[model samples]
Target: MALIDCIVLALYLIGTLAVGLHYAGRNQRSQDMFAAGGQSPWWVSGLSSFMTLKSAGTFVVWGGLAYREGVVAIAITTCIGVSAILVGLFVAGQWRRTGVTTPAEFVELRFGRAAVQLYTWAMMAVRIVSTGVALYAVAVMLVALVPLEPGHPLRDPASGHLSLAFAIFLFGAIVVAYTVAGGLWAVLMTDVLQFIVLQLAVLFVIPLLWLKLGSGAPLAPLPPNFFSPTSDQYTWWFMAGWVGVHFFLIGAEWAFAQRYICVPSDTDAKKSAYLFGGLYLISPALWLTPPILFRMLQADADPEQAYILASKLVLPAGMLGLMMAAMFSATASAISGQINVFAGVLTEQFYRRVFRPGASERNLVAAGRWFALLIGAALVAVALLVPVMGGAERIVLTLTGMLFGPLMAPTIWGLLSGRIGMAAVTASAGLVFLAGLWVKFGLDGPLGSPVLAAWVQANPRIADVLVGAVLPVAILTVAHLLRRTPQPAWRALQARVDAYAPTPPDEHGVDHAPAKVVAISLGASGLLTLALLAFNRDGRGALLVFGLSMLAIAWMAWRVSRRRPGPAN
Candidate 1:
């Protein structure tokens, strides 16, 4: 990396930190800290939700898959959009209607305190460790771009790069600091900025690569199956199951539910989710193309590094730093979003509800900050240990498969149908858990039946979907139908939700400060892109396009900031 690249990256990190610190004093209560005081714009929440779903895994895991399998990766990932649309249409509004401060509170209402504890603790266990794995992956990728000389103080002598441990700690601390300082506001603003930078970086890559490849001729040599949407392991069945899994995930998962709850109204929540769905539906082609085109350039390139290598091949020095910043933003968006949600849950559900029942809102906010620190520390520790755990990624995938179906499916089912009680949730999840264990450990294992093993081998990706997604949902529905008794708490909550009506949210109050911040940040980024033309001439055309785009969005944001409240719809 050039000195200019380093400077650009430094500026981005500092700017993100500044944004966080800027909001430090704005959150006077736990609600403000955790959910932006229900004042965030629907679009902001929507974009944050989308960013929360990404991480370095977008580049490493999905990008690699795109490199090897062509368009199948997009087909698989587009399931996220399909799931989001389903949730937007059926579930997001329901969450907002419940008027719960956190998903844990909803769990407590629909099920019971016991279920809340079960759901919260289980989610934390799986999500925190997986978050650590993502953090580690980000560090590993970024550290590769920061090479060091033989005698450099920060260099790892053995591997001849910046020390991996140091890189992890550095990135982890940055995320934790910003998250602790600004809370949800920070997460939302940074996510919007990240989205802008990511789009600019990727949009530039396409035309540049096209010019290099000289149109459609170079792509002709690729294998025929490369263009097929359903490849070997990622079959249509797997994609359908993926959609089911994410539907539950986005619908009931605390992080995503936080997005719904944080918005102004039920309608806003639906809008946010719909925006997420719309973007996911349209943007995967743009997101996956750089890596796909890179395959034509170097068929033997490391799949995991396809995105970085492709960008590095075409992007000039300062723009490469912008790309790097965008990549870091992906992981930071996810990690910080999770930390914020976990802290909010711990603060609202445990700290205030159990220990300090009469605690003031300020006190609750302080406690939430402390909880954020604790969670961030734990996540960083997990990342440090990921190198020792060879199967960390696999562990995340397996746990997500096993847990999302048994845990989240029942939660979403309970949200939509009041027939199922806590007992039903327990029974459904328990049965699925047992079946999932048997499938994973018995049939898929060496000591199990040879016939079953062969079947599992033949349908490698199908078993998890069947056991994890399809079976749990089916059981939950059956259990709901069989239940003869109605639960009072569920009925009561449903009555409250049904009776509630929302007044128009104050447009002047909603995201007033965040809007200006976004405008200024984007405007500054646009200026910086234009400034790069003075130093590098080879990439002038791409830089101009990026600069103009950022400037246009910044102007729109400025207009939004200055708009007066109109008649309520």
Candidate 2:
């Protein structure tokens, strides 16, 4: 990397740390520490949710698919948007109205304490794996960008492991620093910056690539079946199954569910979901443009490296650094979001609830911070093993699919229906896990069953869809029938919900919702991004504009934070 590029990247890292530290001491109570005291504006939470959904895997994996398969990949990717719409319509408002701090708390409300405890631990494990996969993906991208010699120590089999481990830890440590310092406030604020950076990077690439490759001149001919839906590994049936998996995944995913609880009102929660859906709807164009262009130009390029290779080919020195920052931003946003929620679960669902019910607010806040560090470290360790696990994106999808599959039916059912008992829900979860494991791994372990393995192998995709969607619903239905217990009425549930209403931090007289500051930051950042796009001809000019814009946004944000109340206020 050039000296200018390294400086740009270093500045981004410094800015992220400063933002987190800027809000570090403001969280006086557990609520403020965990969910920003439930005062986050809908738009901020919405942008955070969108960025959380977009991990570095989205860039590497989905871009690879688009490069290999063509526009059909866009249709498959839209499942995320469709799922977001479904969540906004049905789940978001209900989550906010429940008044729970974490999704596991909602499990306690809807089911029982035992169920919530089980769920909290289960979700923590799932998130750790998911975040680890994200870390690994980003580390892979970073290593790819490094100009390693053929026999470099970092590329040697023995020392390459050390290099990979170092990359994972480096990424993890940076994310944990900000997350532990500011909690959700820092996470959301930095996420807004990350979202802007990532969006601008991709948007800039599109026009530049177009002008460079496919200007007014005639484009090169596409490969055979480039425009066909059934051209590649993604058949219509496969796409349908992908949609089915995400439909349930999005509705019950803990990350987005946590966002629903971060807002002041149910309306705000719903609006965030809607905003998330809208962004998902349009994000494909920005995300897929470079890869699509790559497909048309260099037909033989490695599919998974489409976006990275495009950056190398199209972006100049400073702009390439910005794109690298964008990649780091994607992974960091995801890791921070997961770590924040993990800390919440640790403090609220486990630490305070079980170990120290009488712990002070200060003690609990301290515990949450410690847990964030612990969990972040654990995820880094897991990421070290991801290189041997085939592909980072594939591992994430398969693991999350199996883990979240069974939980989805019970979660959605428990929220909407009031008649299901805790026992039934818990049992359904166990059965669904066994079923999903059989379909996913096919009894390849000590408990391997030859017959089941053969069946799974013969119809892998079909079995996946059945286990992920059909089997869970079936188990839930049977459980509901076998245990015909009437749950508490919705009125009673609402009463329980109201009891957990957020306590505003007005005694300090701090305006938690600084709408004006958010507006100024976003408006300034957006205008600056436009300026970079317009001034693309001069690399130095674009770099100068990006730097000044970041400085201006940071100054405005710092000023707003100074007005907010502190611990002693």
Candidate 3:
């Protein structure tokens, strides 16, 4: 390893642990630890939320996608950006008012303790399996470049007896240490730092790639007629459908909700959403440019395979380590954030709310910590399953999108109307699962691969995008309509929940001030869209300038988070 590589990686890890320890005490109280006492700055939470939700799979997936389709990534990105803004306008108030520690907490409040337990466990299981695969993906890349514990299972066919499972464990251990040490606070702080560093690498890698291309470096050959807009990669129908699905998927569920939950107040939540979503619309380019440009420069280079090798060939030791560190942070923070959310569900809704109502608060918190460990272990065990997860590597967000799409549409509808029953919600969830399976079996089999495979060929990401968002929402809405009227108890509960809608701050100006926030937020997102357009039109110099500007804005986000007041809530 080069000195710069080691130094950057070392510094990143050090920062991660430091942030974790920094938040350790906050977690001593379960709510504060798990949910940050419901007072985190909305903007800070929004920034962290983006990083945590995006994942290491993003570069591999989005870049590969961009290389194939060009500016279409912007459409998908816009879908989520729009969805998030809707989430801010519609869903933020109810979630904030409920004063729940986690999403499962709301389940308990809306449904029952038993349902909460089941939902919590189900979410945890999916996350564990998914996170393991994500860790494994990184392991594959590492093995491709660095000789980390040689003969590692990351090598196909397993030479030298280094098990891929062990690499997952090692990585999981790193995430767990930080997660357990600092809790949400630590996760937030470090994520901002990671976002900054990762964005730097993202911007840096582009220029280097163009230089290489200009200098006649080895590269991948694009498919015949690759640049044609009529190519399957750039089909208008596919792009539109993809974006529309995410409109519900990203807008309603997943990590963006986590940000809404973290901020200090409803008004702050709105502003954060507006600001975050505004800029967020553009981040696809900031985060996605490196991989796409890398592929373009290496057009003759097998884009995916080239990226794996390019890091070793181009990035100096320190910068390589820095890039790796940024990657690890993005992945780890994501996993740990989910773990923390699951633990809160376990301790509050499942363990205490259901099984042990009389348990002391402190004991409940300890239980959450233990639950985190258990989930981490499960992830390690499932790392071996990565090879079989099938396109799980490319569709990390989609995987999660599947989980949220159905549930979120119903929840949002309920929150707005203030009358949804647990039975209806649960039924909606069932419908969601069936939709996902159908896509996996039907379309996936036909299109993903014609030959028989052990499991369905449908990538979870595609399922996440299509079946996850569309089918379930339609089914859930119909089911809700066809079902009987709300029960008296349900109405009462809804009333109680709505009673707590946090009053908007007078000075906060939910509509006006948040507009400024949205301008900044949307401006960043706009930049991404513009960059992609420029690149597609062969405006390489213009795209470079736009990217540099985003780097500045992202820096401002980091500074905002860093200087945010602790007592804002």
Candidate 4:
């Protein structure tokens, strides 16, 4: 990379660190550190959340998937777009309403101390492994693209075999340094700058790639599944799932909890969610197109490797370093956000609640920071020791599959299941989910799928999240009949949910009421879902999903329709 590009990259990263440190003292109260005094501007909070939700892994994997798997992959990207709207409608205002420092706090509030603690510890466990994954992604890419020297700890000094673990650890140190110092303020504030760099890097490269390799005639001669939804390789189930998976996993998530916390109020937060949805639409397009262009330019070339190659050998020297830095920002921002929240939840729920319920606020906050540090240190150790899959594509997918499917269960149930307690539910789900993923990734053998007894050897990180999420849903189903819920807890929560949620305030403040609002939401979801189903008949589903989503959103949003946010109770 050129000296200028290196300088720019270094300056940006250093500047991020500096800003984080700048706000280190802002945590006058424990809540401020995690949620920035609950007064972050709608725009800044919204943007930070959007960027955090979209990671380097996301950009790299999705882009690479498009190139390798064909246009059908774009449907998956579009799924994230829809998920953003769901977040706006369901998650945004309610998170703020809970009046908690972390998402796990909602568990404690809605279920009991036990559920919150269990979920928190489980989530942190997931975070440690997930962080390791993020580190691997950023580090491996750096090893391949940037100018790592032979003796560099990231690269093997002698044998030249990839020291996958060391690379992950090396990057972990960088993320923890900035994140531990700044907290959410540091993370979100730095994210604004990171978003600018990351977005521009991907955006600029796509055009250059296309310019270098013009688009050929319509890609009709490709394999049946190359881009066709109707093709065997691209079934409607998979296409439809892309929407479900990405929305829950990325867009509508507790992963970006601070974004909801930092908003001025719940109503404004809802606006941010919707607005961010629109912004999120462009990311996959930007991140995926370059590799596709590269492959078209060199038709016989290995499309899977084209993305990494272009970023490495194809871009101008300085731009390469800048791009690497942008990716680091993307990966780091996301990983640290997860780490910070996980740490906070672990402290408040497990450590403080179960072990030292009487701990002072100061002690709880201290625990949060310490836990983050310890987790960071552990991940670094894992990064230094664990062996990762050789190819980035295989490593990422296997990791995502393990986590993506199961994690959604908790969030979904949290939003929908009113009486079901989260503690036993989360614990059951967490165990089942992780075990399933472990079986899928390890015990399954060379492929790391769930079918084989050899799946025990699969990458454990991915296994944890996927199984953790999926198992909970299944367990909850049985638990619904067998496991008894606390009657008082259920009654108390229902009371809270009912009193707070209001009918949409039309131009006239009539009591639009719950029944009317429910009708609208159900109607909207049904219409769009049918439209999507109609895609087999001239792409009707493709055209109407957006309109239907918006309509369903309008109904779901009735609770937050008022601009004044009803005085925060």
Candidate 5:
């Protein structure tokens, strides 16, 4: 890496910390810290939610598939878009109508406090462990790419790369500091900034690679099946199952539920989800292009590293730093969202609701910050221990997938059907848990028959869908039908949802502060990029185009902040 690239990377990290500190004073109440006081614009929530899913895994995992199997990666990712749309239509508005601050609150109202306690502990464990695994994965990827000077204190002796432990700690500390200090407001704003950086960085790669491959039939030599929508390994059934898995995830998962809850009204919640879906639908063409093009350039290159290698081959000195920053942005966006969501649950669900019912809002906010610190510490510790855990990450991932049905089915079903009482929820979850164990252990474990295990190995995606989505949903439906009676809690909760009406848009007006912050940050990034024209003579056009794009979006944000709403009908 060049000195210019290092400077850009350092500045981006510092900017994230500055954003956190900037919003530290905004939380006079717990609502302000955790849910933006329900004042965040729908667009901000939408963009933040999208960034939460756009992690470094997108590049490492999907990019490898793009290199080896062309358009199939795009199809797999587009499943999330389909899920988002379905969720918006059926689920997002329901969350807002409930008027709950957290998903745990809704769970308690429908299933009793016992369910809340069960879900809080169980989901927190799953989220923390899974996030640690994600952090560890990204750090390992970074250490392979980032080299250190000979005999440098932080360099690995054998690899001459940055130490894996240092990479994990460094990125972990950055995420923790911002989330603990600034809360959800910090997470939202940083997400917007990171999205811009990531989009611009990848957007630049397309033009550079295109210009380099001037006038050639670059894709002619590739296999004919490379362009097929469904590869042999990722077939049509797998795609359908993949879609179902994400539907349960995006429709009812706590992180996404928080996005729906934090918006101003049910309408805003729907709009936010729609925006997320639209982005996923439109973005794959741009995000996956570089790796596909790079496959033609270097057919023998390591598929997992194809995306980063493409950037290194084509991007200029300072811009390579921006690309590296974008990679960090991917992981940071995800980890920060998880930290903030769990912190909110610990504060609102456990601390205030159970331990101190009469605690002041100030105290609740303080407790939230403390909880954030604790969860962040735990995440770092787990990430640092991943190497010694020996396939523990894979185990944790499988466990999380298995639990999704038990966890999400009850919550989503409760929203739509009053017939699904706590008894059904408990029964379905127990049955589903046992069924998941059978699938994972009885069919695929070492003790299982080799023939069955081999089939599961070849079609793991279909098995996951059956165990995680199809079976739990079936159990819940059957148990609810057997009950045939609505609980009093469901009736009262349904009454609240039906009777609630949001404040009129004209009366509530818009909160322009977030838009203003976004505009200023984007403008600064644009001006900085434009200034780099003084140094890079060879890449003047790419810098000019990207800088102008940033400024254009910044102007749009400023316009949003200044605009006033008309009177409502």
Candidate 6:
């Protein structure tokens, strides 16, 4: 790597730390710390939501998959956009209207304290593992891009585990610093900036590759099944089933839902989902194009290295540095969101509710910070151990599917329906867990049912969709109805909804500081981006496009700032 690239990376890390520290003092109260006092602009929350879903793995793994599979990959990506649209229409507004800091708190409101505690611990486990996998993905990319010296102490003989551990700790520490300091405010602001950086980097690469490929290039023939959506592994039935699975997963994804809790109004929450959906509709094409082109040009290329190879082949030195910085931004934004949400759950749902019900706001905030550190440390430890788990990414996805599969039905049912007994919810969730485990692993391993195991292995994707989502939802709905559960009166449920409504803002006092900070940060990032482009002779066209985009962003930021609502009580 060039000295200039190193400097750009350092500056980005420093700027992120500054953003976190800047908001530390202002987040004195629990609400402010956990949910940004419900004052975040819709766009900020929206971009953060988009970036949370778009992790380092999306660039490396999904791009690689797209390169290998062609249009079939695009079909999988569309599920995410469809899920976002469903969330916007059915889930986001309801979550924001609940006035809860964390989804666990909502569980408590609907179910009982015991249910909330159970849900919190379960989600904590899932989130920790998920974040660790995200860290591992980033570390893999780092080791590939920035090689260690042959004799370095942290470089292992046969593997990059030691270097991977170091990279995880280094990046994890930076994420903890800002997330703990500024909480969601810092997370959202940094995410907006990070999202911009990632978009510009990928957008810049796509056109360069297109121009190169269009200039009378002879491409190798694709694999036989490359464009087919119905391969042995991914049948049309399997793909259709996953659309259902994704709908449930999107509704139950806690980190994504946390964005709704952060915004000021239900309208903003819905708008955020819409914004995320719109981005999903377009960004995947930009992200996947370069890798696809790389595959076309280099038929025998390593699929996992598609994005990295494309950048190395096409981007100039200074531009390469910016691209690396963007990759780091993707990882940082994702891990920070996960860590912040975990901290919120630990502090609000566990510590404050269980161990220290009468604890002061200051004490709760301090606990949240400590929780952030603890989670960061755990993620680093997991990253170190991840190398032993062959196919770690697939394992993480399967684990999350099993973990959240059962809970989805009960969660949505609790929100939309009344008179759902605590017993019913608990039993339904437990049954789903058992069912998912039986289909996913128990039959294949512990149960030792060769016939069932063979069937499951033959149709794994379909099994996941059925056992993980559809069947569980159906089972839970049947149980609820068979019990003849009697819902509360409509008026009674309406009263509870009203009670959870947002507190009225102060009439005279309004804070513009957050909006100002966001505007300034966006402008600064734009300048930094321009500076990086100026250093690259081939980046003039990219610079012009970036500059115009930044101007549009600045204008939008101004309008959002002016329309910013006063602080929630």
Task: Judging by TM-score against the true structure, name the best candidate.
Answer: 1
Q: Return the TM-score for each candidate structure.
A: 0.95, 0.86, 0.79, 0.73, 0.93, 0.91
Query: RMSD, model 2, all Cα superposed?
Result: 4.7
Q: Rate the local accuracy (lDDT) of all candidates.
A: 0.85, 0.75, 0.61, 0.60, 0.82, 0.75
lDDT of 3: 0.61
* Shift of residue 456 alpha carbon in model 5, Å: 0.7
Can you write out model 3's per-residue Cα lDDT over 1-569, one digit (the tens) per residue? 45545554665576577667756776667767777766565756777766765666555555556666655554556556766676677677556766556776565556666556555656666667767766766555444444435554444454442345555666778888887667677677666666655666666566666677777766665555543434433345444555555455444443455667766567777776676567667877565555555655555544343444455555543456656766776788678877777767677766885688999867877888788888777776776676676654344655655765565666566655544566666776786787566555654455544543322343334435556666766766676667577645457556666676554333433222222332343244335433344224344554455456655665564455345233223
- Encode model 6's per-residue lDDT on 1-569: one tens digit a residue: 56677677778788889999988987888888878887777788889988887766776667777778776666677667877888889988888877777877777767777887777777677767777777777766666666656788988556633476677888888888898899888888888888887887888888888887887888878877776656676677766666666656666667777888888778889999899888887777678778877887888776666777788777765666667778878878888888888788889877887799999999999999999999888877877777676545475557644556676667766667775657776776787778876776688576668987898888776677667667767776776777665544323545666877654454634555556666776677667666766567875876667756776686676776787565543
Off by over 4 Å in 6: 154-156, 159-162, 215-218, 228-230, 444-451, 487-494, 500-503, 506-515, 555-569
Worst 10 residues of 2 by lDDT: 526-535
Off by over 4 Å in 5: 215-224, 385-401, 444-451, 503-508, 564-569
| Residue runs of model 3 more than 4 Å from their true location after superposition | 1-3, 148-163, 216-221, 224-255, 297-308, 394-403, 442-466, 483-490, 501-569
lDDT of 5 by residue, 1-569 (tens): 67787788888889889999999998999888888878777888999989988776677767877988898889888888988988899999999999888888899899998888878887788777767766776776677667898989999998899898898998889999999899999999899889888988998999899887774645535656877789766788877776777777787889889999988889999999999998988888789989888887778877766788888888877888788788888888888998998899889888987799999998998899899989988988888876576533344436545777677878888988888877777776677778777766787566577887788788666676677778888888787777778878889998889897763544636677787888888898888788778778788988999889999999998998787754432
Task: Kindly list the per-residue Cα lDDT of model 1 for residues 76-156, writing each as its tens digit.
Answer: 888899999999999999988897778888898888899988888888977888788788877777777888999999999
Question: Could you tell me how far off, in angstroms, the CA of residue 119 lies in candidate 3 after the best superposition?
Answer: 2.3
Q: For residues 418-498, could you state the per-residue lDDT of candidate 2 as single tens digits?
A: 667677667767887877766566588777888888876776655666676677777778777765556774457768766
Taking all chains together, the TM-score of candidate 6 against the true structure is 0.91
Candidate 1 is scored at a TM of: 0.95
Model 1 regions more than 4 Å off: 215-224, 391-396, 444-447, 503-511, 566-569
C-alpha root-mean-square deviation, each candidate: 2.2, 4.7, 7.8, 12.2, 2.6, 3.0
lDDT of 2 at 326: 85
Model 6 gets an lDDT of: 0.75
lDDT of 2 at 206: 80
